[model samples]
Target: MKKVLFAMALALAQTAWADGGMDILKSQCSSCHNLTGPAPQTLKELWARKGPDLFYAGNKYRKEWLVQWLQNPTRIRPAGEFYEDHIKPGEKHDEIDPATLKPHVSLSKDDAQAVADALMTLKPKSDLIAKEKIEEGTISKSMGEMVFDKFLGCMACHRIEPDYGGLSGPELYTAGDRLQPEYIASYIRSPQAWDPKIWMPNKHVSDMNIQKLVHYLEALSQENKNGK
Candidate 1:
C-alpha cells in the first residue's frame, strides 16, 4: 500500500514538472523556437524560420549539452538564425553584420533542466536517426580537417573555431558536444533529409569520410573543453 501511494505521488510530481516546463516554453520560447514541426517544405518556409526546429531534439542533441547551453546561451549560427537578414555584401565576400545580430536569452538552471527534459521528449521521426551509424576509433586531426575543408568544402559555411571559418552556417566547433554523433553523420550525409531547403548541399559523403568527420568533431570538442 505504501509503495503504491509513493508511486502515484511520484507520477503526479513528474506530470507537474512536465507541465511547468511546457508552460515556460510556450511563454518564453515559442516566438523564436519551433517546439514542434514538420521541417520547412519550401525555400519560402525555410526563409521564414526564426530558429532551429526542436521537434527532433531528442534525436539530434545530447541532453547534458542542451541543459548547459540553455542556461548559458551562445550564438550557434554565425550569421544569426536568419542568414538573409544579417548578411552583407563585402568587397571580397559576403559577411554577417555583427551589429544586426542579437544574443539568445539564457534560462535559469532549474528552468534549463526542466526545458531540456521537455525537449528531450520530442523525438518525432526517430526512425531517421535510428538509421545512422556512428563510427568508433580515432581520427587524425590533419587528415580529418583535409576532408572537412578541401574535400567537402565544409569550412566554406561552418566555423571550426570561435573566430575561424565562414558566416553562413551553424558554428561546428562545438558540434561534438552539441549534437549526437549519429545526427552529425546523418546530417552531413544528406542535409536535405534534415532540412528540405537548407543551403547545405546534399554531399552524399561516403561512409568512411562521414565516420572520419564525426571522430574529428568529437576530437575538436574535447580540445575545446581542454581550452586548447
Candidate 2:
C-alpha cells in the first residue's frame, strides 16, 4: 500500500509539471516559436517562420544548455531568424539589418527549467537521432578551421569565432556547447531532413568529413571554455 501510494504521488507530480510547462510554453513562447510538429514545407512557409522550430527540440538541443540559454537569452543567428529579411549588401560583405533582429524574451530560472524539460520531451525525429553516432574526439583548432573554412567553405556563412566569418548561418563557434553532437552530424549529413526549405544546403558530406567537423566543434567549445 505504501509503495503504491508513493508511486501514484510521483506520477501525479510529474503530470502536473508537464501541464505547467505546456501552459507556459503556449502562453509565452508559441507566438514566435513553432512548438508543434512538421517543419516548414515550402519556401513561403519557411520565410514566414519567426523563430527556430521547437517541435523537434528533443532531438536537437542539450537540455542543460536550453535551461541556461532560456534564462539568459542570446542571439543565436548573427542575422535574425530569417536571414533574407535581415541581410543587406555592404561594400565588403553582407550585413545584418540591426532593426530587423529583435531580442529573445528571457525566462526566469524556474520557467527556463520548466520550458527546457518540456522541450526535451518533444521528440519528433527519433529515426534521425537513432542513426547518429559520434565519438569522443577532437581536432586542433587551426587544422579544424582550415578544413571547415578553406576546404569546405563553411566560413562563407558560418562563423567559427567571434566576428571572424560570415553572418548568415547560426554561429559555429558555440555549436558543440549548445547542440547535441548527433544533431550536428545529422544536420550536416542532410539539412533537408530536418527542414525541407531551410537555407542550409544538403552538402551530403562524407562520414569522414562529418566526424571531423563534429570533433572540430567540440574542440572549439573546449577552447572557448578554457578562455583560449
Put down candidate 1 lDDT per residue, 52-125, tens digits, no spaces: 98878888999999999999988999888788799899999887799999888899998898888888788885
Candidate 2 on 1-228: residue-level lDDT in tens?
A: 999999999999877777788899999889988999689999898889889899999999999899999989877789977888998988987878898778888889888887887898999898998898897766787888888888788888898778888787899888888999999999999999999888777767888889999999988877877887
Off by over 4 Å in 2: 1-4
Clash pairs, candidate 1, are none
- Give the TM-score of each candidate: 0.94, 0.94
lDDT at 147 for candidate 1? Answer: 93
Worst 10 residues of 1 by lDDT: 14-23
- Give the Cα-based TM-score of candidate 2 against the true structure: 0.94
Cα error, candidate 1, residue 4 (Å):
3.9
- Prediction 2 global C-alpha lDDT: 0.87
